[model samples]
Target: MNQKQSISYVISSQSSSQQKNYRTKLTAVLNCTRLLLMQELSSRGHDESKESLNKENLIELLNWYVARRKKINEVLFSNAPRNDQMTSPSIHKDLVHCCAVETTRSMINEMGDSLFSILVNESRDNSIKEQMTVVLRFVDKSGHVKERLLGIFHIADTCAQSLKDAIDAMFPTHGLSIFGLRGQGYDEVSNMSGYHSEILERLNIEELSGRTGQF
Candidate 1:
């Protein structure tokens, strides 16, 4: 029988007073754990018996599961070099960073005396990692609208200063200066772009004061 059918048969026959060897009983426990690890699936059939199974079928299913899992683990770890096993993501990121830095640098080189609009946004991709996407939008020297991702940086926190620092680190490398910044735009995020966002306040205030020779 296939894995699914064998599993169902084992569950259904659990309450039967059939003869069960030690292996069958252990397989029942492991199978129940695997099913219930689904949370929703495990919550069902709680009142059902869990100890009886056909000894041979239970052993067969257990072996099938083990063999399949072993092959997967082997494929994932066996051919991968030690450094690549853990650092693949970092290497990909380094390559992307190089490409983005080059792209933004070239765009700036063509920008000349033209001013541009900067768009800022944040996204939470993983449970723990918050990333900021920086983009530049403008009509270039050729008079065509152009937009490009400058970079995506990890922001340790969503607070205003953390956001500012992330972009600050990228600006000089890409030939951007606040004095040449024409406009800044971001959504209504409380700390960075909201009605009273601190970064917005800092940048807007600078724009206003420069005209009056003030802060």
Candidate 2:
């Protein structure tokens, strides 16, 4: 007839072994307000029956899982800062500040007995306009050699004065001073390496005078 009547009929007609299975237990839960069959299944150590919930409890559990799933979906699709995210350009100020601090520290480390050697080279572009690239090479406090490109400036003339002014401007901008210079060198070109160029001499004198506050 109905689920309750069927469970009752099975329990009365079938052997106890058949009655103990979920078939009967499920029928009883769907039909009977009293859960006597469920309790018997529990006493028998039927794990499925033991873990089973009543209608109200099952509905409550389903609601909880539904709410939990909604929350998880929201979190997954939401715009939030995730792990391993890179800093954007909006925060580049912090990155630039750190670079400045490192530059200052590097200059401080080059303070004592560090050789500041200038290597100047000239190259012409497609327009045949010559440009000078100055490289500052020195040993840091850790005894490891370091070098950096000072600048690459278009030179109106390869004369010592123009190259010197461009090179000199770059030093102070980086919090560096030429007084640390201990050596001078240049490419094979006469304007930089040759005595006739006089650029190297001016650099040496400029550096020396800087040491004594002459400039």
Candidate 3:
């Protein structure tokens, strides 16, 4: 059987308590290593600790500390006022935006002076809002090709010009310039294909040779 099948079979054969015990033991091993590293750092005067440095004692302390913190957090969250909690819709949206910004920054850093092409498409979201999705394709410093979704932008319409304007507006926020584009791709639809020449003329993207095709 395959590795996944083997793992599934093993998990299915084990009782719930057995699985729990196995996970607890695995966690303890990791915690034990962390505690040992902390003790080593303390010995080097990089940190200070008053707890016993014995292996078993350190493992027990870490297990207790983790369990206590988990319990405390659960209790606090259960009792805290809903408005004071961090699980609000706005908070989640902010967190997601932050993650997207950081991820895009990292991707750009990886691309680092390399020419990149963009793939663009327009579609209606579940809410029937017209949105344009942009993706970047490039070779990294190590010569591996990478493709990353740049962003999805809400547009006023699905016309070629509207889609092109939306993409243009997004570039400045990400510190990108139209001159850096080496190629462009769009869905082979009537709305996009019919205006290919117009888009090429308006954007002055000479690299695309007045045509749009898949990357």
Q: Which candidate is the best by lDDT?
A: 3
After aligning candidate 2 to the native by TM-score, how far in Å is the CA of 29 from where it should be? 62
If both were scored by TM-score, which would come out higher, candidate 1 or candidate 3?
3
| lDDT, residue 214, model 1 | 29
lDDT of 2 by residue, 147-215 (tens): 766556798877767777777776777666666665666666666654576765666665475454422
Q: Which scores higher on lDDT, 1 or 2?
A: 1
Would you list the rank order by lDDT, best first?
3, 1, 2
Every model's TM-score: 0.50, 0.42, 0.59
lDDT of 1 by residue, 117-164 (tens): 678899898676899888887788679988877778888988888887
Q: In model 2, what lDDT does residue 40 have?
A: 32
lDDT of 2 at 211: 56
lDDT per residue as tens, model 3, 45-164:
222233545534433454355577653343233433444333333553454456567778988888778878888888899999998888999998888999998888999998768866
lDDT of all predictions: 0.58, 0.53, 0.64
For model 1, the superposed segments whose C-alpha errors exceed 4 Å read 1-97, 203-215
Off by over 4 Å in 2: 1-113, 204-215
In candidate 3, the residue pairs with backbone N, CA or C atoms under 3 Å apart (3 or more residues apart, or in different chains) clash, namely none
